[model samples]
Every structure is written in C-alpha cells, then in structure tokens.
Target: MATIPAKYFIALVPEGKIQEEATALKEEMKNLFNLKYALKSPAHITIKMPFEWNENKEDKLIYKLQKFLAGIGVFDLKFRDFDRFGRRVIFVDVLPSATLQSLQESLGKFCKLELNLINELSDRAFHPHLTISFKDVKPKNFDLYWKHIQSKHFNADYQVRDVALLKRMEGRWKVIHRFPLTEA
Candidate 1:
C-alpha cells in the first residue's frame, strides 16, 4: 500500500480570544483564497517543519517523539498582526520572543535525537507564524483578503502543552498523537 509521510509539529493553538479572531479570518479566507485550500480552525504557531515518515513506521516515530518530548516542558506564545506571503498565503505574525526562540531550539535538538540531523538553513530559522491562508489563490483577490484581515489583530496568548505527530492521510493531514512536554 502507498503510505503517507508524517511530521512532528509543535504549536500554540489559539484558545479563547485568538480563536474568535481566527474564526473571523477563516471566514474571510473562505471568500478570498477559497476554503478548500486554507487550513482548518484552531490556528497556531508551528515549532518545526513537517517531518516525513511512512505509516508502517509511524509506531517507531511516535515512540521516538514521545521520548524526545519527555525532556521538554510547556511554554507560552503570543500572536500579533495579520500578514501575507505575496498574495497566495495569509497568516498571523508572531512577535519572535526569546521564550519562543528557546522553545524552537529545544525542539530542534529533540528532533535531531529522534531522527537524522537535517541541515537547517539560516533563512528557515523559525519566524513563528500562524497560518491563515494558502496556495492556488488568485491575484485579484489579494486586496479583498487584505482588507478583511488588515484591521483584524489578535494578540491571544496560549500555553504549549504538547507536540503533535501528524500524517498526510487521504487527501489531508490528521494528527496521530499529541505528546505532552514533561520533565525529563
């Protein structure tokens, strides 16, 4: 059987206040980029890029992730402004704080322990953005999407209790397990 690749991502999903604002932005995306390509609810700040793995190997991957995360603890994240990449994507920009940076660093080390030490590029240094839009978007709709998102600013703060192991199943992504960060 053809298998899907899995990834490990740590994120702070908008809980109370941020969820409300993200909902509104999602609605706007429905009109702007078309709902099919945009990400679903519970918008968040990603800690690591999606890691690739096969379904048959998922069990080992999960165990590796669990052990790696055991040494780390929870952290806080703050969301700030709406920004777009060219005209294809929209997101909530996170004010890169020292705490967030440290979390990313720690997660990177954990990933290296679990998997191969992939070369992380300088430009790919975690900037901490909450995705709000996506690809296959039209140029004409950029202004319309921007107007709807410009005035909307969400500064919701949330705690990062866990990291998720996600797989691209069917035609979309789904979480296989969420590993809580705990004391080593």
Candidate 2:
C-alpha cells in the first residue's frame, strides 16, 4: 500500500474583529468581482509557501515546528491599504516590519535545513500580503476591482502570537494546527 501525499503551508492568521473584517473584504471581492478562489482560504499572511510532505511523517513535521515556535516571540503586524501584484492579484498590504521578515527568513531556513523541505516560492523574495484574489480575476475587471478596493481604505493591526499550519482538504484550506509564539 502507498500513502497519499499531503500539502501544507504556514501562515499568520488574525483573530477577533480583524479576522471578521478581512473575511468581509474577501466576501465583497467574491460578490463584486465574481472571484471565488479567495474565499477558499481564510484571511492570512503566508509565512511559508505551500509544500508537499509524506503523510506518514506528519508527526515529525509537527514536532519540529513545536520546538521551533517555542523560540519565536510575538510580533506586531499591521495590514494597511490595498495593493496588487501586477494585474492578476489583489491583496491587503502588510506594513513592512523587521520582526516579520526575520521570522519568515528564519522559518524558511529552518524548513530547508531541519525538515528537508523546499517550497516552490522559496527562491523568490518574500512579499507577505493577505490575498483577496489571485489569477481568477478577469483581465478586463482588473482595473475596476483594483479601483474599487483601492478607493476603500482598509487598516488593521494585531499581535501575531501564533503561526498556523494549514492543510488542504475537500478543495479548501483548513487550519490543522497552531504553534504558539513565545512571549518576548
């Protein structure tokens, strides 16, 4: 018998009202732009790009992440304004912070060295944004979508105290585990 592979990614997810607001924005994108892809996953800022792993080794991944997160301290993150990656994607902009960058870089390196995992986006520069929609955006509607979102200001900040591990199942991403960030 052969085991099926599992897909996973790590991210920082906001809680309380911030999460509610982000989800509302995503819903608006779906209703206004007819883009449903963004609704598949909860609002989040990606810390690690999606990667594949053996199902049988899932416990090992969780164990290492637990240890790794024990050393990570809480950091403040702010999402302010709207931005796009070219014409295909729209997202809420995350203010640049050294703490966020260091955490991402450290997590990336740790994944590569300790877990022997290499993500597809690992080579590219990390641009952390909570996506509203991606390639599903129609070319003709790009401007309308951007203009609509850009005109409407969005700003929120929250302390990031945990990183979530999401797994894909039934065509939706589910938060399967959360690793608590140690107090600074």
Give all candidates' CA lDDT scores.
0.67, 0.87
Could you tell me every candidate's TM-score relative to the true structure?
Answer: 0.79, 0.95
Which ten residues in a row are the worst by lDDT in model 1? Answer: 6-15
**Evaluated with lDDT, which candidate comes out highest?**
2
| Residue ranges of candidate 1 with Cα displaced over 4 Å | 1-20, 32-35, 40-42, 120-123
Please give the distance, in angstroms, between residue 95's alpha carbon in candidate 2 and its true position after superposition. 0.7
RMSD of each: 3.3, 1.4
Task: Mark the regions of model 2 whose C-alpha exceeds 4 Å error after superposition.
Answer: none
Q: Per-residue CA lDDT of candidate 1, range 1-184, in tens?
A: 6786554444555456666677667767776557545454256666666666675777777787687768777776667777777887778887668866876787687667666646376215677787777775677877877787787766766676777655555555556578886642
- Candidate 2: which pairs clash? none
**Which pairs, if any, clash in model 1?**
7-51
Q: After best superposition, candidate 1 residue 147: deviation in angstroms?
A: 1.6
lDDT of 1 at 61: 74
